[model samples]
Target: MLIKVRFFKCGILQCNVVLNEGDIVTIWIDPKRVFLVKLAKGKRLDTDKGYILYDDIIGKEYGDVLKLSRATAYLLRPILEDIYLDLKRPSQVLYPKDVAYMIYSSSVEPGSVVIEAGTGSGFLTISLAHFLGKEGKVITYDVRRDMQETAKFNASVLNLQDRIEFKLKDIREGFEEKGVDAVFLDMPSPWEVVEKAYEALKPSAALIVFVPTVNQVEKTYLEMEKKGFVEIHAEELILREYKVKEGATRPKNVGITHTGYIIRGRKSIKTS
Candidate 1:
């Protein structure tokens, strides 16, 4: 497998450094199993093949492999998906399947200011922060302080605390940002805030809503249309996995069928 080396800024001066303790890393045992570790000086990780001391991994470079008795562990840099999937959060997250599409359909990229509602697990917020890079910012709002705390902690784990601004306010009340590039809604009552989202976004900016039920989708879509949002669309994403072998390959019987419905629309430049 090809290896890539990555570096991140460490301090106020923004000096780059190698991987260190508390940095999240991916240890691959095989094609099927991988482990996410936060390197600490005194910690130990025991796998089926063998145990590894954190001291051995704390200062090691990414893309390096440590050979154990029974398996070869490949240490690599962790991606957004890797960190997100391994997260232990109390709230239900937007899966990778949904996230990928949401980013694509909404045209979220580097240097785009984005607003996100209902920061449940911070998965989506993290992804937005990553894609926005250093040039852009994510303003995520949530009502519950506890949930916001969870999301804030997750952002800190990935060293993205500065990129996201967490707002502990109710969306129904209103949003702080105006003329933003895009808005993402993952809340229970997205329909209730469509007008607010329209006001927050810049003209021609995208308003994307993720809902779990068809009724919510219907209500949100109608609200967008009634509120004069153009280019309206609603979609459901389904993903299936397949097990492949040299001669045997088949789709997994059970797959991710329906996680949520996405409602997308562009803020209308024409107003009645």
Candidate 2:
């Protein structure tokens, strides 16, 4: 039953935790390749490389490796990326390269309050919750019921539902909460909500405007300026990964470019 055993004694436990039914595990095969499985009796995992029976992994230590027919996979704990990969995208979600920078630039931190509009697929909202820790809260607004429901389900799957509040009202109606640390707008015509975002944010809080086209950026930027925001800036992120080889390391041809432009501005004390 043991495929590749760790250095364990015959009588005592090798690790503090053991794999059991109803527990989620991350199966690691290679770089950028992983699978999440809910361990249960009589269940099996099939992959192009090979298949793994749950019976083999049910009692194994988390760090143990299991040999398949043609490959080996390591049993490890799940992480935020694992949860992100498993989301059901009802709309185009923001890339991690952009999400990380946007959150960091907006000064969103642990225990901070955030408000975001047009919660597309909940990827950004989920990322915010993960970064903000348990003491933080995210209020996400979406106009469509279906999209909001899907986002709620995705957050629940990742066990982040408690950190987020899903609202199905149009963001143009204005947000209910005020004095938040940050406000993120991802919907069309974020320019229309600039004043509303200004009202919701605390004094000197950041407002991030995300849009797909330069024209939209211009419109949003002008509105932000006229709305009395200060220290405004905009940026676009392009991520290109590289294939590493001992002799010929080169950048990959397929790079994620032009996902969107992120514009940041701070709420002015004059507005408060």
Candidate 3:
């Protein structure tokens, strides 16, 4: 919610946060499926079970259940997964699981200046904008306007357009920003941009790269080390979800397993 909200009680679900207009709400049909809806006065969410009017639940709290014609739905606060789950994908987007880990382990915190190369589908772009707070901004580069436009639309969905600067430029020319907090590269040849990233990062700031293959990891790590980056290492995140219930809580059969390898390095004081 954009406004200050206090504790508001609901019938079956108790919550402190009140739903507001423009707040992205998750309509939970079941554990396996959910619909992310942006709340608006006249917006109607058409579901397989039933249609829901946003006006009806604008003032309600999360965890409240909407009585539908054939089922009861839960109104939930959208998590990080929910936000990206509903994005418009024009290409193979960076998985949200890896996005979370990269941001968490990187130097790109709230209010920090960050440079991102290869703005593919804006999954990582929007995620960075959302967590960067009002003080921070993301300058993302891409060569394709269509992809960049799609990314812009996705960012607008969360009202995060103001926090991001979408630049339609080839990153191979090098990032325009100097001494930024962090540099995240999500391109096929991230090794090619290590020198550019090193040039753009502030001293001691982190440089993170995402690649899907072992050879890519090897090349990126070698480049980072050769560029005199310190604390160089790589990690791959494996996320498994569990179905929680009274007595049937267990791991889901299949989920996000291997999205990419995250290679990290800190800018060295001595440029080699």
Candidate 4:
């Protein structure tokens, strides 16, 4: 996949470059330090190691190693997890681990009418839009216009603007659209919107809530039960890393231990 590379000076100032197909490039200024970078042709990127000419990487594939002027080498392609964590988030963004779980648990697919509340930095919105495709619709709501605008910018950047609908209304009252396949709640008081979600979702539709605290999770769970939801389940994901080297291969002592808990349930379908 073609990608753009951003070089950081002292881990602050950034210089961006684009990489074309079959490009081999060093992504880090210091070979010793790990950094995210892309490959491109006819571009020269300056680094402490040396000037890395884009031509050097023109024939390399993704994950290929490229050496700098000082003969120091770094990885060429950006990992999806790295890109998701490195997004420009002006608000609390959903972590990739949670996103993966949500997408899997919700069973979101093409042509799914997914409704998401509180478009916080558009991370989840982008993920959902990508998974939904052209046949799907992502109706996202944020009370703040600024947040909506930011999300719109992010969606456009990812070429997912067409699949998303940005609404500036508070979803606590209720969503205007009906017959949604799934509902994802990322707001502070998701319990307050349970009824709204129930009303908007189709019978047997999935409802997933993301909350930072167990208290919120418990409250949301009770609300779902009270609102006639079924098959309720909740889990918190803790991602640990393993250092894979010649002799060392163990879980990282400290990794992203906790982000939030996800509570999921389905609205019960009435049977005559």
Candidate 5:
């Protein structure tokens, strides 16, 4: 299969390389290596290494080697995580660490109904929409029209526009949907929406709150407890990356150490 290669470090350069028949391709690329990429016919790519002919890679296998004018070699397929992280965002976005944890903890599935507040940059919204698949629904609310518009563009790019409902309103005042499977709050004062979230979630539904400060977490936890939420807990994730090289194995000096705290709980069943 012909695959496109992108450099995580270099934001501007993308390589389209062809996979010759009967060849196997690795899906990962080293960020530091220079690559010559083939583009579609009649397309050209300019790189610091040199100009590359788009036609050269038309029939190569995914892992086949391609040479740039500078003789630098590059792989054909790049990892999906690299592409996701490199996506352009109009606003600050939730990191993958937080999104993964939310998806796992909430048990988001093919038919889940997910409600999200403050869809900044639409990163988490896109992820959740993908996880929910065709049968699921993702309803996201934001007060800023520009943010919502930008998020719509991002979702469309991912082919998830049909699966998501973008509401240009503040979730703090209220929401339109009820009986949701999961609720994700990424707003500044998530506590303000706790009551509305409780009303919207189905019994025992998971609720996840993302806040950047300890104060916000504390307030949200207190409100959740007051609202009769069960199993209330907060956690922060730190990603420590390690360099993998022959004879050298140690954590990278710098990694995604801290982003924010996540507070999770379930709506308690009300007894009459």
Candidate 6:
């Protein structure tokens, strides 16, 4: 099925009018499955469920149900979770389960200035920007320019490009921004950059690290203590889904576990 399309930017993110040509829309199949597409005039998207015409999507408000040739789906705005799960991953990322805790522990909020290493597809970088709102800033560093460019593109998709400053350099060489509210490291050798993170953070600010192995967590924790960080702690998160069939309710046999270890601590002022 093909039809004509129209569009207008309603608000900062989501709006009521149907998506227009060139608008990026997420076709939500389920929590675990979603399809993203840039709607264009007279274009059609073929899926296992059915064929979705770009014209049929234009001007439909989000949350409206659409009837495809084979199935029904929801037209909706893509949230941070959708972006994180769907973006092209050139490197591993901190999933929402772990990222939530990291953001909470670091106390990232509106107007907060934060630093992060190894952008890694910009999952965490965009998350921080969402948390900081318009007044805050996120300075993220990555050694590879290609990865940084990918991250920047993802930020643009989320309309958060202005909230982040991407630096194509090694964070271990030291940071250009100082006294930041928080510094987060998602690199393989987070311990190597702990001192640099320490120097970049303000007194009482947080330093958070995410690593997949216990060895990395141990080394990072020790380095945090040695670098004058206090209240150091480490944790891991496991998420399970349950089959809520009313009469037959139980935990799903498959679930998410052991994504990574989060180590956090606070920088303290050095007294003479």
- Ten contiguous residues with the weakest lDDT in model 5: 20-29
Per-candidate TM-scores read: 0.90, 0.86, 0.89, 0.78, 0.80, 0.89
User: Residue-wise lDDT of candidate 6 within 1-272, one digit each (tens)?
Assistant: 43333221232454455566777778886665578666779898777888888898877867888887667889876655677555778887778988889999998788999999989889999889888887899999999999999999888776678889999898778999988999989999999988888888889999999999999999999989988899999998899989899799999988888798999999987665
Error of 1 at 103 (Å): 1.2
The predicted structure with the larger TM-score, 4 or 6, is 6
State the C-alpha lDDT per candidate. Answer: 0.84, 0.83, 0.83, 0.76, 0.75, 0.83
* Candidate achieving higher TM-score, 3 or 5: 3
Instruction: Quote the lDDT for 98 in model 5.
Output: 87
Weakest 10 consecutive residues of candidate 1 by summed lDDT: 7-16
- Winner on TM-score (2 vs 4): 2
* lDDT string, candidate 2, 96-173, tens digits: 888888898999888999999989888899888877877899999998999988888877665678899888898788
Error of 3 at 206 (Å): 0.7
Q: Write the per-residue lDDT of candidate 3 for residues 30-67, one digit (tens) a residue.
A: 86568877788988877778888899988887778998
Residue-level error in angstroms, candidate 5, position 206: 0.5
Give the C-alpha miss distance for residue 54 in model 5, angstroms. Answer: 6.2
**Lowest lDDT 10-mer window, candidate 2?**
4-13
Off by over 4 Å in 6: 1-18, 30-33, 40-42
Error of 1 at 176 (Å): 1.1
RMSD of each: 4.0, 6.0, 4.1, 6.9, 6.2, 4.1
Q: Enumerate residue pairs that collide in model 3.
A: none
Name model 3 segments beyond 4 Å from true: 1-18, 243-250
Residue-level lDDT tens digits of model 5 in 214-242: 99999999999988799999999999988
- Residue pairs with clashing backbones, model 2: none
